[model samples]
Target: MFIDGRGHITLANRMCDDIFQADTSEWLEHLYYDCIHDHNFVLFIQYVFLTETHAHEQLYFDDGWSVKHYEAYGTPVTNSKSQLHGVVVVLHDITGVKRLEEIRKDFVANVSHELKTPVTSLKGFAETLLNESMENQDVQRQFLEIIWKESDRLQDLVGDLLELSRIETHNFQLNLQPIDLSKIGAETERLLRKKADDKSLQFNVSSEGNKEMIGDAARIKQILLNLLTNAIAYTGEGGEVELNIYEEAEFIVCRVSDTGIGIEKQDLPRVFERFYRVDKARSRDLGGTGLGLAIVKHLLEAHEGTIEAKSKPNVGTMFTICFPKEWSGW
Candidate 1:
């Protein structure tokens, strides 16, 4: 803020001080635009003075070191005599929020594309079946089967989407109990054994400690199933898939690793996002709902746990789930 007519600083907030990286005494006598790098800010100040009205605008500036965006709002100050005084300016930081909004929009578009493909396929096959005669059973049966499979895929996708929403909103309550992480890992391995066998992959599970925790046993099982199934899905014949359970600090850590087609560096961070696929065509062909990792992420959060991935291209990916042991009430 500066004096109304003389353009001399009357007061400046801490934020403005930080922006200019100077003390109030050093900058008090300076014009409003004296410390601003952008010429537009100077023009904006002049316009506000001319109109004698409050104004709000976005300003971009650089200090020869860093660039920043500021949402600036200036309100006219007046005394009891109705004489114009200095303007009060407020700056808000919105850069992070803007970036997140962009990400959310991208996620929505991706999900729409993911849902559209299967729905279109299902609709087309159903229409084909309806247009054909039942007497020519083979063709009718083929189309019907395709329609049925696509319908089931759609149902699974919808269910996962709903689960993701519930988990995010904390609507899914945990039926917490004392559960052994090793046992859960073993059960998941057994359940996923068929899948591994189908691909001629080797499945293994190991534990280094008690591997026990208090958590929603069902949700814990779901988390294991998703990770193990993901491993089986990506691993090739003769490859090895391993589940390692241990206690790390105050958390129960379970790591599922596979010798499969590893994810690229750029894709690792986004793998937990809904409908995010490294290979869209292949993911569809494999009947992936594209919500598996997303669901896993939400489940971990609901459990007050965390999950992370470490991978290298053409090598493999390791997903680690860490559950807070203190949360285990059982």
Candidate 2:
């Protein structure tokens, strides 16, 4: 912002338009106070005029869609004789920094909450084994088993958190090679068959045809395992989990479907967020760290691929992943 001898806008930058998402044509003919709506900012500019000195301050507002943060610097323009004639204000965009601060706060809160339950369970079970159940071998064994499982869950959660931190970094890289996704799918199916059979679930995998593609085979297998494990875990007895791989145009598509309890419509968009669980209690019972889908998402991005989901309550959910025939890592 720039005001002239009459305190009217004379040299307003294009940022005036960018900040409001509108044209600043009318701003040219109006007095500075009349043109600017933020009273705090206007008052600061007035302070610069009243004191004939420079001032700096921060301001923020929401334009309905999103909140914007700004730090403004105001200066008084004076003549050769030191007569104050005008004021100039410059605004710095600080929304990204504010957002990062918010994300950091949320991450700390979420990690604390995620670890609390398992840690409490471990403590309680250990206490019972030592103080209350020492004379009873059967009860001691049960408490010890619970302690072991909770410890395992803690380990898995830590491992996933580290892996996700690595994957989310801007410089993360994949060791790409020519590998057949069909083979990976077969191996994942074999690995998870027992898990599905334990609940009498029907597990099936079919490849339209064997096709070799350039990708990190281990990561691809990780993707399949996470998806398959999630499906089988959520599914009930006698449910069906199906996996299919095929080609369409220049993309290789992998589709996994489950006949189990489905995600609510409102939860679909956030299903890929780290530590998000559609059914928290059920997920804990199934030994999930709530990072499986989040991992799947980041791994797919590393492969220059996309993933999407569709589901209905009580019907089931299907996950579709598409990989471009050729990708140049950015």
Candidate 3:
């Protein structure tokens, strides 16, 4: 966009029309303030004209649906005598870059906070045992047990972080092959049945149709393990947990449902986010690193699969995952 010496929009391009959500063709020769609805952009142009120099700023425009970020640069257009003619403004989209920066910051903060809790506990308990002379062996054993538990939690957190990082890397690829979902479901059930039984939860696995698909067997098992483990962990004593695998169209679907302490409506969407927990205290007590769901989501994405979660607080939660019957990796 170009504004004339009299602050009139002498020229405007289609890009300007898009950024401001207006018709630049009709805006040509109109006053900048009259045509441009974004006050910050208009002020940027005015500042460049007033200063008769280059100016730059980061600005955002909301087009009702969503907000978009842009890096705005304004340079004064002048004659050979250094007399101002107009100001030329350019906007470069930086929404993706800004979003990545935000994600990076949030990831770092979450990892640090998660690591700090266990590390603090380990240090405190170890210090108590080393610095203080304890007479009761039982009390000493209790401190040692807490230190060991914190160390185990820290190890789990680190392992999950590494697994998530590996799955998220650009070069990550699934070891796709012909696999049977029924077999995987059975194996996962056997692996976690003991935990469910310990809690007296009723656990079951059933399959119908053809449960065969082309994907990474190990990652598929990981996905099932994460979901099933969460079900057992969150459910109360004698609650029911079910794993149903079946074929749907060209996809193999696995649905894990549990009569557990369900997630609230508002928190359901973010349940897959790293370190997100509906019951932080209970999840920590259950030895959950909080990255299980995140890992499941990433592994599903790697296999070009999809997952859907539904729940009602104090009732139950169900997670349904679908994997394509055939996959040609990109």
Candidate 4:
């Protein structure tokens, strides 16, 4: 955009329409202050005109529904006399870059916090045992148990972080192949049934329709394990957990449901976000790294599949995942 010496918008480009969400053509001949409402942008232009030099700023424009980030550069237009004629401004969209930056920062912070918790516990307990040399064997054993548990939790957290990182990489690909959902469901049931039994929860798995599909068998099992484990962890004694495998149209569907502490309406959408827990304290107590659902979502995306989560607080939660019956690696 070009602002004249009188502060009027003398020229504007098509991109200005998109960046400012207004008709740039209509802005021509109008005063910059009248056309551009963003105070920071106005200030940036004014600074360039006042200093008769180049300036740049990162600005954000909010349009009620969403916010957009922009890198704006303003430079004074002048002739050989070095007298400023006007100010020319340009805006470059950087919303995606800004979002990635925010995500990276959040991820780093979360990883740091998660790692610190277990390390702190392990260090404190180990230090106490080393410094005190308690004569009571039970107290020593208790401290050792805590140290061991924290170490195990730390290992799990690291493993999950690595897995999530691998899945999120640009070059990541699924080991796609022909697989059977029913067999996978049966296997997962066998592996986790003991856990459910420990809580006296009624666990069941039923299959119908055609369960054969093309996917990464290991990842499919991982997805099931994550969902089933979460269901079991959140459910109480005498609660029920069910895994139903069937087909819908050209997709094979697996629905895992449990009478667990369900998520709130506002939190359901973010259940798949990394390190997000509906019950943070209880999830930590249950030895969850909070990356299961995030991994599940990424794995599903790799397979060109989808997962939907529905829940009613204090009633139950259900996850329905669908995989294409056939895949050509496209």
For all predicted structures, in order, the TM-scores are 0.77, 0.86, 0.84, 0.87
Query: What TM-score would candidate 2 get against the native?
Result: 0.86
Off by over 4 Å in 1: 20-27, 33-35, 58-67, 127-139, 170-173, 186-190, 204-211, 244-253, 264-270, 273-275, 301-315, 320-330
lDDT of model number 1:
0.80
Which runs in model 3 stand beyond 4 Å of their true positions? 21-43, 61-68, 80-83, 328-330
* Pick by lDDT: 1 or 2, better one: 2
Model 1, 1-330: lDDT tens digits are 554567777777777667666675666777767765568777777777778798999886677887667787777677898677776667787667766878889878877876897789988887766776668788778877888888888888878877777776734687887888888877887788888988888888899987777788778888889888888888778898999999977888999999998999999999897788898788778789668998898878778889999998779999998888787542
Q: Which regions of candidate 2 fall more than 4 Å away from where they truly are?
A: 3-10, 18-35, 47-54, 63-66, 78-85, 128-133, 327-330
Per-residue lDDT of candidate 3, residues 172-232 (tens digit): 8888778888999999999998999999999999999998777889999999999999999
The CA lDDT at 20 in model 4 is 82
State the lDDT of candidate 2 residue by residue for 84-190, as single tens digits: 77888889999999999998998888888889989999998887776763777887888889899999999999988999999989888898888898999999999
Instruction: Tell me, by TM-score, which candidate is best.
Output: 4
The local distance difference test score of each candidate is: 0.80, 0.89, 0.90, 0.91
Tell how far residue 73 is off in model 3, in angstroms.
1.1
lDDT of 4 by residue, 78-136 (tens): 98998778999999999999999999999999999999999999999999989986999
Q: RMSDs, each prediction?
A: 3.9, 2.9, 3.1, 2.7
lDDT at 68, model 1: 69
Ranked by TM-score from best down, the candidates are 4, 2, 3, 1
Clashes, model 1: 1
